[model samples]
Target chain A: NAGVTQTPKFRVLKTGQSMTLLCAQDMNHEYMYWYRQDPGMGLRLIHYSVGEGTTAKGEVPDGYNVSRLKKQNFLLGLESAAPSQTSVYFCASRTPRTSGKNTGELFFGEGSRLTVL
Target chain B: EDQVTQSPEALRLQEGESSSLNCSYTVSGLRGLFWYRQDPGKGPEFLFTLYSAGEEKEKERLKATLTKKESFLHITAPKPEDSATYLCAVITSSTLGRLYFGRGTQLTVWP
Candidate 1:
């Protein structure tokens, strides 16, 4: 089964342009997250959703917006791309704690490489 | 403040040479600690999870051990294919669904 899949594997945007990265997971996980990875820096959370219709800010949510319209999909939108936002983006999904298992592990997508000029 | 730190920033080892990576964390309460291996141009792949102190897990050439304040990932007789960035992340009591990640340790194994 394709656990987690991200769309637009690679993209290039000029400054001030807008784009969206789509993440879809078939694991039926209840929680989904968006993160960005840069050189010498760990993956930083951008936004997360505990479930459908619920979204929350994460450690690095600025300049990014997220939506979880469905249980299996999480979308990350950059309203206005900037050079600083040119980083590899990752999406992950996790099962809820109530799954009666040690469900702290996350299944990640391959990642979407975005470059802003 | 709650945070996770990993060191030494990078490491280079000869084939069959063994070494360990360190991940130290200070948070309000520790729920679980996780290890992930990331290769170039790819996503981080899950390795092991330690829930409490004095716990250890092993797979292939890697062994992960955890204590109250830190976790260690030991590579035994590494091969060139084992080269990758190892990441450490933690789930705190205050942030059940969120994981705080360390900068990660880049490991290079040369044949």
Candidate 2:
């Protein structure tokens, strides 16, 4: 039951560096989301994908980019890492809200902690 | 504007104590309200979902009740394992799968 898995459980990057966070889900869900968790800020959505090739920006999408090229994968990219971008990133996936039994239930990954200096 | 708020940023309780955590929201059209439990260095885990007013759900030592404007998660006889940050979120008409989250309430149950 590898619900959702994120790569590079921990990472540290220098300013101006670029990296990608990979998220994979085996649940065959159609909705994938990326959110960053900070103290006193809860979890703010960064970007999300509705299907295999559709992506949309969320509340805090200034410094992040996302792509969903396949149904099982969603990738979050940071072109230029900043100290302010240091946060714990969580990836979640859920089935579409098409059925009464499967509406608005999100399965999340363990989380990836990133540090920038 | 849609917003979700959680009261009492942090709470401390002795083992076996009972209490409630509050989540308030003001959204255009409420689709669903969600509760999650987050531990240190981990992502939030789904707990319960309330669809409309006057709905109640219970699991183990936690019972959740919802109204039009707010929802309450009542914890009965909390144990140390129940200590974690409780998060509240909402999905409205403007958001399909996106969730607007509250700042969360950190709970500590000392044994």
lDDT of each: 0.93, 0.93
Q: Report the lDDT tens digits of candidate 2 across residue range B1-111.
A: 899999889999999999999999989989999999999888888999899999999999999999999999999999999999999989888896688789999999999
Q: Point out where model 1 deviates above 4 Å.
A: A98-102
TM-score of chain B of each: 0.99, 0.98
On residues A1-117, what C-alpha lDDT tens digit does candidate 2 reach at each position?
789999989999999999999999999999999999988999999999999999999999998999999999999999999999999999999986755633667889999999999
Interface RMSD of each: 1.2, 1.4
- TM agreement with the true structure for every prediction: 0.97, 0.97
Docking class of 2: medium
lDDT of 1 by residue, B24-93 (tens): 9989889889999999999899999898999999999999999999999999999999999999999888
Give the C-alpha miss distance for residue B76 in model 2, angstroms: 0.5
What is candidate 2's DockQ? 0.72
Determine which window of 10 residues in candidate 2 chain B has minimal summed lDDT.
Answer: B91-100
